[model samples]
Target: MVDQSAPLPSVCDLAIWEPVLRLTPEDGTERGAGRSARVAGRISPSGYSIAHRGSMPSTARIAVQDIQRELARGGVREVVFRAEVRPDGLTTLGLVWPSPAVEPAYGSVNLGVLVLADGSLPAPWLRRPDPVPGAVPAPSADPELLERTLRERLPDAVGATEEEIAAAEARLGVTLSDELRVLYRVAGGDWADDVETAIRVDKAVGCEIFGVEHLFGIDAASRFPGWDLGATDAIRTPPDAVVQGLAGSPGWIGFGTNGGDVFAVDLTPGPRGHFGQIVLLGHTESLGAEPVADSLTDFVLGRLREERPDRRGAELPAVAGVGTGRLASVQAAAHPALEVLSLDGGDGPPFHLAPVAGLPRLRTLTAMPGALADPLEVAGLTALEFLALGVQEWRVLLDAGAVPRTLKAAAVTVRHQDHLPVVPVANEILALWDRPRIAQTLLEGDLGPAAAPA
Candidate 1:
């Protein structure tokens, strides 16, 4: 409807950006008068796709898909756009090319540097378990009964020996919790030749309990959202929280899965948690695990509830947002232990970054285009390893020679304007770190005039 099969990255290629433009306010809708959008998706000979959030008017939806189709004709395979328009007109139409530069977190609109050019992960991945001194198991923990219950349920189940369990502890450097050790001793997690995984679940255990040899501890990097969505992630454990909200812990012995999600025994408990509680790691979530049962005994007894008492999070979040309907500003989100600060792009004046410039543990910062009052202010974030900001903001930083030298990776956010000019700015960023610069083929064409407003 807006534009079809336009040439890829062609010079003066107005048609290439027209489809996206139609979705903006130039059509004269009051709602589109001034707005910004973040989009990510793939395009190919098959057709075009877009990762737009929420429902859209049918006309806009068709235009959204058309944008990919139009860009595909130009040889663009994948696209991530940070586009904005105003009552006056679009000042900057920004497009981030070779989306692979940003970590591929499929089905999610990931912002910022996910993986460094050196093939290293962000700070969150390097997190290790904190020392939980004198931690002990809960009163409900019953190694003898846990093993006996499984023995009764799976009478034919083949179990592991104590020597083998001891061997696992030696190999992993983490002692298995009492209940967990017994659960493996009873079933050893492996199924027999005659019993299918599903059949074994119904016959004895409600979940597929893993074997002694299969256990992996806190360093288990199992989730698939990749580094971008996870690099800035943090968890909070409230005073009454049963599980210590953590990115990862050496004491969390991952034993098995609930058919899909991984299950672990949390030896490093929260102040309110028991020593050996059963916690679940979501298959898709890239962050923290939640408490599922007081002990493995409860998991086997079917006495489990999925809800967490402090499900919303700690009174103060390790990851904070500055926006409307949320924390009012950076000062509100600032804390000594703050790890991430994301400035939301609502229709407002730019936010000042001075409030959080001195947070010691702060490592990641992402702001929507036009979201920051001064990009140079980011130079003060010495601990920053990842930074994402608008191209204009980056120019001010680059020109002033103020780009934070501590960044391991960076992303250039953009808003409505020609993309060709943005490529130089992105390359400048990569050049700063001596990282690989983006290579894009440019083609030029004009799609004529804008259509009359409905």
Candidate 2:
């Protein structure tokens, strides 16, 4: 008889593993799986490895294909044929498996292999997906796959109805954004059952879908008001280098004064677009005239999505609250093809207005109604490329010494109702005004270099 311990044949083996779960099955009392059994610690690149223990079944060859598809849903990267084995009085067996990367684990683990020699491991006990090191013995040539990874695993919240979502899209004159679309479909208007669970999965283990808010068109500031969602926070708009850390956590996503104002949205839900829920705290009054989305939480998300890229050319969201403390406090950050910002204005706690260094390619800014008022300020926006402010707000900035050191171009017009001096100031500085459409005047020359009177 062929020795059964010869490592089996190369392409016909099946391997299984079960990751240790922190909690024991207490007679199905727990609502969800408890914490992972794997402890937390530094894991060496080569600390653990896995290999198959036996051969696969002959009749189950076709059945194995179905398993591959299901595993993909869980974000398994690759799968391939592993080995073949001949049980002593039993027929030879064949097995196939995936070549998943060995990630760090904190606790004890178990691996199993099935040999189908008339008396092999029984069904249901043959294989299971678990957190195991080097288990399943990766298949040699598995192709890569695309899957949505959830960053946070909070329980699912209530989803929007098809009709409700459609109305929102029409009212906004834009789509619901990609991620929101997915949530709408998956949630089917009822997702509270798995909202919290989903969040935990994202925060703890590596899952197929990550709840990154950055991926979607929605801005973190509007989606989650109250926290310093401005340039200070990381997840919504982290720098180029810190992007990876923002993608995962113990890091958080929010915008407010004390930090209790937390908000999180899933970025992957709207793959073809973008979508997720937004939580608000302390500043329910922050959301503007637009109606709230589904719930107050979702309302924030809907508004954020509206500001993102639309199907038509790269359209920009109208900036609301420009010159006032409202516009001054609106957080701004750089995105790949565009920028993400929140126009919600309020008495915010101190926060950063720009990245550590600065954003170089900012092109345009629009003002929403009531965005800019008498006390407007725009003195610090030196790197801005294009400036568009409500005409009335522009005068406020002019009155408050709102000066652009090097403005390449500008488009300022107070809204219809109010009227201010067409030309507020006159100085050599006025000559520096890039264009002359509204109030054109020549500066009176530098007055003793004291910045031309306040």
Candidate 3:
């Protein structure tokens, strides 16, 4: 039998670690010859760190995804990993299997909302495609011109059959726009691999066009707006706005990418938008798509351009932050349309929720430790559905039975404390909803001191 003591390949593999210890920002503390890392963050070469995140660089991320799936197949809901390096050159690693709540610490792709017994989704995820009862295609929508232009560009390319095109539409449960229908009829994307497909599409169509079989509706699920971030998103489609600021829309037919973003055809127009306008959905950002051109015709005719529309003074802001460099206080962030408000407890004074008390749309509040003047002040934000606070604040609420019953999810935020202690608090919050508790099993192992660098 093979030696079972060897480490199982997982995200916890220290060999795959990035310079995270390098990116952690300095905290006026120093590690002597070997005192271990003084602080934590995404370590960088500058003796500081970036945000805590999973692996990037594609390769590492894919490996993490594969391992997570394997773990899930084995009935693991979540895995929380911890690595401690001591001044004596001893490193200890711990793995918490089947964590009760979906831990977001590192190498996690499960960004969905906390489980609710009724399976209710956050407000942002509840959006459906708005009806454009009498909307017509934008004036620039010229299917004939688009087809002629594409056919001219790819004379030798193969076109998708009428039956094939219909099959794709049927699978997506929506009819394709005339220009898009014509575009595919001329030449449906054909490539053996994603890399070659991207290369071919970039050269043939000025961007990466998904194959006929790859077409999909850019709905909320595609973005995976987990509760942590989704709860804070607000829908703001002003009467004059061109693109509705929504989590997603059924009318949005996603057909291509700019490598890191998506391009879609809008079937559900905003109050001022035209049907069949071309829009871009940035993969890195949350919610909403931005208009790139008036129509698919314009998009292919050298009118292709991506300019971020000015949302400032154009619509009501949806998310706000209050802290030392952010809004002066809760009063400054108050608005009838506000949805997510985050308070940072940097070096600034504490904040009072009095200014934002009773705001109808407020649903998610994330207050760092010491950020709130009074932990009980949160009781007044009656509309809150997801609240994240420091352990002490949660303790106060847990003790007073003052936790907002409206909360569908809650989290205990901590900076320097080990996660083992936080599990109980998270379980306490989950108990309020009669939801499943976060369960942690500690498995520890030690690796002798690090080897000297060559």
Best prediction by lDDT: 3
Question: Can you write out model 1's per-residue Cα lDDT over 1-454, one digit (the tens) per residue?
Answer: 1222223434234355555544543243432333332233434335544544345467655655676565666666655443443444433344445544555434433333423466555665666656678677777778887878888787876678888899999998877787877777777845656467537644465676666787888663544245556656766656676776666677888887867887888988877778888888877666678788888888788778567664446536578888866788888888987888888657877889898887888988988788988788897788988888777888899999998877777766544433335557877887776665554443223323333335
lDDT of 3 at 97: 44
Best by TM-score: 1
- Give the least accurate 10-residue stretch of model 3, judged by summed lDDT: 41-50
Q: For model 3, how big is the CA root-mean-square deviation?
A: 7.9
lDDT of 3 by residue, 301-375 (tens): 868656666643422346888886777778888998888899995977888899888888898898877888998
Q: Across residues 1-454, which tens digit of lDDT does each residue of candidate 2 receive?
A: 2222222232122222111111112311221232111111111122322221234333333334444444444453322211111111111111112211111112212111111122211111122212212222112111111002221222343334667667655643444434445444333243235676544432322222323222222232333221111111112222211112112211122211223333433222211211322322233332211111222133322223344321122223222232334345444333332332333233333333343124443323434334433223344444443344444555566655664544433333232212123223221223444322121111111111111112
Off by over 4 Å in 1: 1-48, 51-100, 104-115, 196-198, 201-203, 218-220, 238-240, 305-307, 311-317, 344-347, 417-420, 448-454
Q: Rate the local accuracy (lDDT) of all candidates.
A: 0.66, 0.28, 0.66
- TM-scores for every candidate against the unseen true structure: 0.76, 0.21, 0.71
